[model samples]
Target: MKTHPAAHEPGHSSAPLTGFSQCHLGILSQLQAFEELPALQAAAAQAQTIATHTLALFHDAVYEHHADEERELFPAVLRSARRGEEADFAEAMVRRLTAEHRHIEALWKKLEPAVKAVAKARPVELDLGAVEELVRNYAAHARFEEEHFLPLAETVLRRNGNHMEALGLSLHLRHTPQPIGHI
Candidate 1:
């Protein structure tokens, strides 16, 4: 009977980037209050399924985001940056993000086995604490991008009015499943 807001509301400006962020937020909120719902422990265990999906979504998103920056955004901003401390700061961010993506990928690789086991209802399982930690870290990463990286792209790297829209559509199309019978 419970449904997401979007499920009930039609004609919304739906996009997967925001959708995934909201999904993670919903999952995290559920996990935070999990102790209060002992009867829903079985449902909580379904978080293993959510975790697997989250990892795949992030894997695709981050790879595309990094590629977008490397291919278009970063070079544009680098040219506009004041050629000293500001440029250095942007470079630092690029380095930090590149390293962070690798770290996140490594963490997800470790998490995959645990999630698979949980999905199978096997005795092997992910530590709730570790999963929470990973989620929190990713939340911070998303916040940084939304707060800092996106603004930079909008102001400094935007060459055309439609570049961001084009990028958004490209990312949204990735991983979207096609109907099997659609000709």
Candidate 2:
């Protein structure tokens, strides 16, 4: 895959969100692999490994993707767009994306306990339903982001040009560890 300049830089705080959105979609694709029958049996063992790596990519991409929008991108565009309805429209889109993230987090919390129980059993047959739920929620969240959020960001946020690259680098610098969501 070709690398976006903003995605690779550590100090660029102006990159448009498409850099992070595409990065997030990549992580989502890897999460789907855990749902496959061949991979499901190993999901528990792979949980820590996948979760650690995914969280790293996710923090730099998804978490900051929203933050950049709420803090910088949306505000930047909202200034020039219509003062009332268009502003509200951008805010509404941000709220929707934020809500989806919360929804996915909620499901992840529920799924964690179930995953823990299976982890205690190790190689034993785990609850496929629990795993399915997490995967489903994450997949849906990704679709929502791609279909709704990215379009608005591309249209509204990309107008600033090269700044997005700087923003992407700054976000990449903030990556950190995340706890596994309880089943």
Best-matching candidate per TM-score: 1
Candidate 1's residue-wise lDDT over 22-98, tens digit each?
99999999898986787567666776677566656756776666676665566656666566777787777767766
What stretches of model 1 exceed 4 Å from their correct place?
Answer: 1-48, 58-72, 79-82, 159-183
What RMSD does each model have against the real structure? Answer: 23.1, 27.8
Error of 2 at 156 (Å): 1.3
Highest lDDT, which number?
1
Taking the tens digit of each residue's C-alpha lDDT, what string does model 2 give over 70-169? Answer: 6665555555445577668877776776687777667656655545455454434446786688678778867977796567666665666655554565
Model 1 residue 121 CA deviation in Å: 2.0
Judged by whole-model lDDT over C-alpha atoms, candidate 1 comes out at 0.69
The number of clashing residue pairs in each candidate reads: 0, 21
Residue pairs of candidate 1 with colliding backbone atoms: none
**Residue 161 displacement (Å), model 2:** 1.9
